[model samples]
Target: MISMFDSDVVSAELLADIVSVSKATLLKWEKSGRLIPSQNSITHRKEYKVSQLIQFEEVRNMINSNWDQELNVKPAKDFSSVELFAGAGGLALGLEKAGFNAVALNELDEDACKTLQGNHSQWNVIQGDVKNVDFAKFIDVDLVSGGFPCQAFSYAGEKLGFEDTRGTLFFEFSRAVKEIRPKVFLGENVRGLLNHDNGKTLSVIKSIISDLGYTLIEPKVLKALFYRVPQKRERLFFVGIRNDLVKFAKFQWPSPYYRILVLKDALKAGELYATDVPKSEGQSYPNRKREILSYIPQGGYWRDLPDDLQREYMQGSYFLSGGKTGMARRLSWDEPSLTLTCSPAQKQTERCHPEETRPLTIREYARIQTFPDEWHFSGSVSSQYKQIGNAVPVNLAYAVGRSIIALLNSIDAEVDLGSDSLAFNGSFHSRQLTLLNT
Candidate 1:
């Protein structure tokens, strides 16, 4: 997954694979004069080198990244954290990899609790509603983190504050930070949070975070594709430092992996996994549906089918506006998977296999989410799907965790020296700017 390509010069097909686009799409780009490639001297076939492809952001990031260096980051001291809404330990496991010790994890779902406790018996798994659990007991924790469910706030007026957010799950997350009084807090949510309720929801959230005596860093949505997860999932992350320690916090978002990962990397015995995806049960389409989907090509959707089949399969959606691309969609092996939903065979968002006619198996879904093969899910099939779907991808979480570790390390340096002069150059400052701007 880290070393994305074997050769410096690659064919057009390989280039398409690297960028997670179809070769036909590349042809279209060339026709539109967006991208024009050189031909190899001997074969006279289209070829591109890393330097020549710098115009493409994906290729440029792959060339500029310091992913190997970032992986070497280590915690300066024993940092402890308390996690709320810890579903099946994806975030917890990733943070653990990044050197944070979980002091406690709160989850209301019994199956998710079992998954957490089953995987790590030593974790102080608090299996109950977060509203009932008191965070006051946790003292001197380095971080308090969670992906609280987003609920729109009731509009009382133009400005909304902490008390105004009382009934929402975001308030509970804010409450934990208030009680624990950690040096820093981390929150994550879907990208929709940015525009929720026409931005009022996020405005209230920003206000509440400030009301709790913390300095909220401008929130950013991190793409899983840039973090070595073989899926195009995006999550909005909120990081805040206690006002007293805000001066010490010099945080940079995690660097992109040198190369993006695709479905081939996930399911095959390659950089991402030790073996091909393990066999497991998965949802299946009915006979008629399967027969209809059999006609669909890789990376294609309902529109790829014959006219009669398209009308039969899409029903009234056949006449709908917008590109109903997810309907009857068959994933491409060369591209990262579409963002995974709770189920594989949903009518609105079908996730059919690249070559096979059936839906992806449970193991395939877990692999795409970057869950370790050994980690066991602890509930019925549907519950397992729900837990994994709700989780932040493990690799994405690990990337964010490393950035947090760097931030904490900087704080430590500041505390010891009593000045900003001891600032930790913990980020890929030069490289990050280049990739981000592009």
Candidate 2:
């Protein structure tokens, strides 16, 4: 048997560099059974043993070399998109960057709906429950997109179908996909969806998409921080292509940006924007809370405070294990903001300004998510933050949009190559099924 700890233990940072993956990705892999790290019994800190590293040739190769390259390219063509659950338009705006025109957007929240319409008057903003809408009405669309909420399916039999999933938001999303039958569709959701109900939810989702006559790509969880957005947000993205088109194309995930964007870049006039984040309505901590937080330095948290202050601030949570890094946290200008919760002022996930003693304003939240400055959010300041927090980062969406366009372009190429001839034959349906299965 091979020794699991033949060499010295390596820190996660070094291991990430050695493996050519982000620290977060390495951690997620550990959690997902892809990798296992040895733990120091006394300190309870994780470390990758050198013996374990030697087991993976890929990591050993990266550890022995150092090289970085960047790619620059433009979209081949301008594609069109119809988005559902368009919160604060983060994904919508990103798709726009990939050269996709937003033809229609649908969201149930009155404020988010208003936000979408207010910013882009040309867009058809439909505000209501998705169940009430008829997506088939929109024809000739190139892409259909949504960050649809994931809900458990009522499994009546071994396999789930379109009708069996009724009453769930995913059903509406699938309904739209079935009705519109666009060239491609993109679905985004929280990473938890993968393990929800012990992964049954995702399994059913895959089944339904397959049954609906689309080719489901291997679902992937994309981290926003890796894609240039400064936040540590992760979302599961599902890509589906029309059955007839899958065999004709290959799709690649977007490459990560060379440098990470940090809090300063978001709020200050820098690479992310031309000017500092515009002053706008922001939530403030109470006088007592503000005084307590004043003691924390930029990037510091409750642990930096005196014992008395830490006790008072953390209260019951102080006794709990695991780093509650969010408590009394003063965000560092050099790092990405922790995932923004719907409520910025929430005690568990406080996203305070680096210099100031206040919650990030609605505009700052939008900016962090990469929503263009010109984009306007509607409803109360609180509602606006909720919409922004719940959204997919715009840049991530753009990257995914580019991938969709590439897939579509590949399909077009195949058509030109005589791979998809328009001949009415008994084999057409079977060929479509075969393409989808691939």
Q: Against the hidden reference, what TM-scores do the models get?
A: 0.87, 0.81
**1-438, model 2: which lDDT tens digit per residue?**
122222366656445533457778987988887777888775455677665666565444333322122123344566678888988788888888777888888889999888888888888899898888988888758889999988888765126477888888888888888788788899999999999989888888888888988888999988776566877788999999887777787888776553456788788898889999998998889999999999998777889999999999889888989888788888877667878889888888888898889888988998899888888888888898898899899888877777777777777677655534535554775675565444
lDDT of 2 at 67: 17
> Top model by TM-score, which number?
1
Model 1, span 313-425: residue lDDT tens: 99998998978888999998877898898888988989999999998888888999999999889888888888888899999999999999999999888766643332444
What residue pairs are clashing in model 1?
Answer: none
> How many residue pairs clash in each candidate at the backbone level?
0, 0
The weakest ten consecutive residues by lDDT in model 2 span: 64-73
Total colliding residue pairs, candidate 2: 0
Clashes of 1: 0
The lDDT of each candidate is: 0.86, 0.78
